[model samples]
Target chain A: MNHLLLLLPLLMPLYGAIFSLFFWRNVELQKVFALQSQVATLVSCILLFMAVEDKGILTTQVGNWPAPYGISLVADMFSCIILLAGSVTGFAVFMFSLQGLDFPRQAYGYYPLMLFLQLGVSGACLAGDLFNMFVWFEVLLICCFVLITLGGSRPQLEGSIKYVTINFLASSFLLAGIGIMYGLVGTLNLAEMALLVRILEGHESLITMAGMFFLVALGVKAAVFPLFFWLPASYHTPPIAISAFLAGLVTKVGVYALVRLFTLIFVLDTELTQLLLSVIAGLTMFIGVVGAAAQTDFRKILSFHIVSQIGYMIMGLAFFTPYAIAGLIFFMVHNILVKTNLFLISGVVARHYNSFALKDLGGVYLKQPFLALLFAISAFSLAGIPPLSGFWGKYMLAKAGLELKAYALVGVSLLVSLLTLFSMTKIWNEVFWKKKPDETEVALLSPITNRMLHMPVVMLVLFILFISLYAEPLVHLAYRAAIQLLDSDIYIRAVLYQ
Target chain B: MRTIILSIAIRLLIPLFLFFSLYILFRGHNHPGGGFIGGLIGSIGFIFHAMVHGPQHTVNTFFRINFYGYQHQPTQSRSIYLMRMMRVNRWRKRKRHYLERRNRNRGLLHIEPIDLIAAGLFVATTSGMLGLFLQEPFMTARWVSFYLPFLGRLGTPLLFDTGVYLLVMGIVLKITFVMAEE
Candidate 1:
């Protein structure tokens, strides 16, 4: 029963995508089907979490095969928590996509591809083997490629090409790393490999090398530091729906993979790797925020901020303490929701104002105060204002860093948070508070009803407020997930035994 | 522009391709052949036909034969036939309604080759769900060892393979058709 529950999230999307294809002509049915599937996924994830809460960790071998020989699906607290967050984001994005995506693109199999992408994400999070993780990533990436290029506009094509090329390179790096690990350890199952890594002697350097490959691959995906160029170039070109979904989920999956790999399988040479990660974390935070300050485009600024937020998550991982990991977990869930909401709000603004350029956009506060409020809530939450979801994550991370006496990294994190606020303020001022351009013919664009556009954003904003006012349960869950992550033995034993 | 030799050769080869595809699909029951390869081969038949006779003709013939066939038989009195049919079957209204809705959709948007892909996917997913009733996990293979007079050992995997075959072919057909259209 638990095994079926574990498979439900992944399979729901798979079947949804398959069946959605059959309903291509009836776009309404397709949208409802996709939305229902996402809702079902959300419920299953909740159920999985409840089960995990009761059972400690749930593991299932596909085709009734035992672990080590068959593909395994394991959901510890960490995986279940992330899957839950992902499904929530998925549901929100599907709601947004229904009215947000243009007709031609929607007709081009948008919902099916989105479901396929969700399948990839769910599979990646729950995959108990390195090879399966890679395959899942490929599935996720392939769907993204099609989604990004769905419209076949010049800019979309250009962006997709860059996105595809860099991602392909990253996949190669991941595969190379997986191949090396398999060669060295003679096993692909993560639990078996973790056991092997502990028992095997004299292969620390090789293991570290493989770990480096995984880092580089995931770093590119997470858009950390130098590898982040492809993100801003490509993310702003797709339809706002696709951009919002990608912004919310894609890079976070990278962070999830990074944290998973480092904490679970690649624990060797931690001092050196952790030190290196801290440096990257500091750099990633600083560079991302600074870059955001220079962007005038709404989605582009959010894209840069995505890089910065990732840095904070990595910082949590870098601290390598259970507290920091807990913080990272909280930060990831918060960022995914907040970031997706911001992008969706941006889409609404772009639709109304007929521009993504902040310079042309103005008087949003005067005209649509509610949209402005939604943006402010998400943007401020993103910048770590007190009592909001982001604040708790940052607080946990900062305290964790201070405990480790990593003052420089802690200072950088604080500085980055401040700069993130500056960037958000820049957007708030330019896009919302500034005067509308006189020459712009806002009347030329047909009026889109606020209900379809604002519904998802409003729901997300309410969610942010809820998480903020009631952070205790979430914080506790993150803490528990972190503890489970730190104690790798329990995860291994669960997978092996069950 | 019609090349007699090329057209003739394609006509002969199309059936052979289809025959080979069926052979491959049946062989997939035990051997390496399956729905995917069969679908590929079958699609190749249509693709070849398109290349020889043009995609427009291929599409017209295919749709005409499969989607819309003559419903009312040619009679000395059309009114009498219609009245008799209407009186004979009250359930015909639902069928007529379905056809009307389908025809309306067809007028709204010409069905693209991608529709085939979607149908193929639907089939694949349905076949995979056959195990759901047995408390097995999704897509879990359930086999039945029954011997036929001519064939042997049928199972759910064959259904799955057929689904895969159709899906792959549909996808390839959609892609190739779109490219050709452009």
Candidate 2:
């Protein structure tokens, strides 16, 4: 039963991808299969959470091989929370794709690629081995390359070229890092690596170099400051549904990996790596928000903000304390829901006004009050307004920073929050409150776009509201996750000795 | 007429280069030379030949080596061949008309070695590097044995080397075909 719970989420998506590809000619069946598989995966995640709520940690050795020789799937508080968030957001995006899509014939491949990406995300979160994590990251990246280029327009191809090239370079760095680590330590299991790292604490410089390599690679993937040019150039070129999905989850996976590795394997070299991360985080937030301020396009602004929010998550990890790490986890969850919702709402606005440029769109709130309200809620939540999901995340992080006496970082974080609010309001005034453009020609929109756009808005808003109202359990979960991460012995024992 | 001799010289050199590449790939596990270097060497061989003999001749040679029957009697394998033909025809027709109208006074520039080299490097580098990067990152030393008559034991390193070689070759051939039509 334990093993079944471990395999269900992965197998469901794998089967769905295959099913969709084989039955590609039948579009309706493909949608049904994709949605059903996503729901099943989500349900499986919930079940696994319930089953392992009290258990210390769950590990399943795939193919019945020993720890270092075989692939292992792990479930801890951190992975379970990430998996749950991935599934819920993935399901919402799947529904949005079904309804909001305008070019189904060309997008026949999108569903399968999305399922494969989900498989990769789940696998990455659950993987206990270094090589397996690399494999899963590639799986997710390849699918993203395809999805980003699905429309094959000039902008799509250009964006894809940049996206693929940078991601490919990042993968090379990841491979090099893994190879060097394996060559030095003679092991590929992350837990084993953690043990070996502790045993070789005298050789801290080597480990620090390896940590830098992994950080840079994962940083590129997460859209960190210096390596973030590819993100804003490409993220807005994908179909709205793809944009929403990626905006919600992809970079967060990188942050998750960074947190996992630093907290577990490279804990010995924290000061050096953390200091570098702190400086990078500061620059990343400031630069990203400023870029967002300069952007006139709605989606582009949100895309730039993804880079900024990732800075906050990285800042939390840089603090390297239980409270700070817990705050990072909660903040990540909040950002995913709020960011994805904003992108989807932009899609709806685009549908109504036929433009994503802030200069071209206006006065949408006059007609669609529900959408306007949803947009306002998501934007405020993103800005960390009081009693919202983002507020708790920011408050906790600020508190954690204060405890660590990182006064400047806390101040910068607060300043970034105000800037975030300012930009969100800028989007609001341009997109919803201002006067509508005088265009005598109104292009008829499909019913699919109208219905599909609302699902993500409703689903994500409810998620934001739920997290705001019921922050206790989730916050507790985050604290437990942070504690488990800080105490590497539990993770090592679960993966190696269990 | 002199160009034909140069083409023959290049053709002869290709086999020698291929042999050296194979040697490098096999001994790469213990030394510096590996699949990536070997694939580049093999691609360089084909590219040199294409530079002297032209893209059509190069493609013809490729089809002969592979015995990919569709390239010889394209209409017979209509489904896949038709797609290939469509792409080739469209490219040629468009380029021919454009060049005829744009540069009627000057004759067409003969294919240059530098162009082939550029295309070859792009093809060989991307394909060779991507093959290695896409595989198991840390387990390059793990060997899998397969019994064969000539080679006593073949391993993953050799298999990956061969894969890189094929990828480089395919990419060069495809690029040559596309560039020729224009």
Candidate 3:
């Protein structure tokens, strides 16, 4: 029963995707199934998190093959927390997609694809095998490619080509890394490999090489400093519903992989890894923020912000402290909600003007003050203003950095936060404060869409507020997940030793 | 492209291809051939027919199945909003929607190739769920205790392979139809 509970979150989406696919001819019926499945997946995720909290770590072997041989699905506190957060975002995005995506796109298997993407995400989080995780990544990659290029518009094609090509390269690097790891460890089970890695003592160099491969591979996906050009170029090209979901989860999944690899399998060379991560984190934050500052498009700014905020999470991982990891966990969940909310909010704004350019948008405050309020709540949280989710994550990271005496990276992070605020303010000024641009018309959203769009944003805003008000429980949960992540023995014993 | 000899050959070979494909699919679990290979082989028959008879003719003849008409055609200016004419817009939309829905209600039922993919996914997931019922983890191979005369032990793996077969067939058909469309 407990084993089934561990597998439920991943299976729910699979079931839902299949169920939705059965109604492919009827878009309305598919939508209903898609939403129902999303809610079901979300509920199961909540259930899984609660189960993990109550039972510590839950591991299940697919096909009764047993650990080390069968494909193992394990839900540690970290994966549970991420899964829970991801499902919430998935639900919200699907809701937004209902009215946010164009009809043509909706008719073209959007809901099923979204469900498949969710399945990939949950599978990636819960997968306890290296090859399994890679397969999930491939699932996400294919889904994202189709979703991004669904319309096959000129710009969508251009952006998708870049997105697909870069990610294909990343996938190769991932495959090569997994191949090397399998060669070295003679097994693909992550927990068993963790145990073997410790026993193999002198192969630290080879292990680090494989680890570097992961860093680069996941870095491209994560949109770190040097590999993030495809993000801003492509993210703004797709429909808001699609972009919002991608912005919310895709890169974060990469960061999650990096953190998991470092804490679990690649702990032998902490100093070297820490040094390299800190540098990448610093540059990613600085460059990503600087890029955001230069963007005129609403989605483009948010896209750059995704890269910048990822730096903070990686910085949390680099410190190699439990407190820091806890902070990373909290920060990641916060980022997913706040960032997705901001993108959804941008979707709302873009719908009004039919443009993402800040210059082409204005008078939203005059037209709909409620939406302005919604945008402010998410934007402020994203900028790390006090009393919101982002502030807590940033505060924890800065404090943890100070404790570790890593003043340089801490300072870079602080400066980036300030610049993030600047970009957010720029958006506020141009989009809401200024007069309407003369050339652009205020395209009215349908009443049904108006209701649907606001519903998800308001829902996410409440979530942000809940996180803000009840920071203690989440902080504590993050700490617990951090403890689980740092101790690979717990994972190993649960999987292999039973 | 529709030469007499080639077309006739394709017509004759299609049955042979289909039979061989099913032969491969059933033999796949024990031997080297399985659902994926079987699906590819099965699709080859259609592809060959398409090459000789033209994609349109093959689609009209070979691909026709259950009716699934009444697609919710998007309303004109469905996304546009005008504040001043709000009530008028709503009323007009309501009437237009009713008329269009009724008109489209009588249209032909034509299921597209994408639906097969959905069916494929459904089958694969069902195969995985077979394990859970028996207190096993998902995707666990469950087999019948007794064997039949011609068929070997029946199990979820074979079901899973069939799912793959449908999925591959669907994807190939969809891609071919799309690329071959006017």
Per-prediction TM-score to the true structure, in the order listed: 0.91, 0.75, 0.92
Predicted complex 2: CAPRI docking category: incorrect
Per-residue lDDT tens digits for candidate 1, residues A1-498, read: 865798889878987886777677777888878988998899999999999998898887775667898788889888888888888888888887877888888887899899999999999999999999999999999999998998999999999889999999999999999999989999999999999999989989889989999999999999888788789889989999999999999999999999999999889899989988998999999999988999999989999899999999999999999999999999999998999999999998888778899889999899889888898889889999998889999999999999999999999999999999998999999888988875576633334556877788888888889889899989998999999999999989999976
- The sequence of per-residue lDDT tens digits that candidate 2 reaches over residues B10-43 is 8789899988887777667667777668767776
DockQ of every predicted complex = 0.37, 0.03, 0.48
User: Which 10 consecutive residues of model 1 chain A have the lowest summed lDDT?
Assistant: A441-450
Question: Candidate 2: where are CA atoms >4 Å away?
Answer: A104-107, A440-449, B1-182
lDDT by residue for model 3 (A356-434), tens: 7888888888888999998898899999998988999999999999999999999999999999999999999999888
lDDT of each: 0.85, 0.81, 0.87
- Each candidate: RMSD to true structure? 4.7, 9.1, 8.6
Q: Please give the lDDT score at residue B138 for candidate 3.
A: 84
TM-score between candidate 2 and the true structure: 0.75
TM-score of chain B of each: 0.69, 0.50, 0.68
Per DockQ, what order, best first? 3, 1, 2
Tens-place lDDT per residue, model 3, B1-182, is 77888888888888898788777887887888988888888888788787666665566556543233223346635334233246554664577546444533332544445667877777887898878887878888988899866557778888888888888877887778667665
The alpha-carbon deviation from the true structure for residue A78 of candidate 1, after best TM-score superposition, in angstroms, is 1.8
Best by lDDT: 3
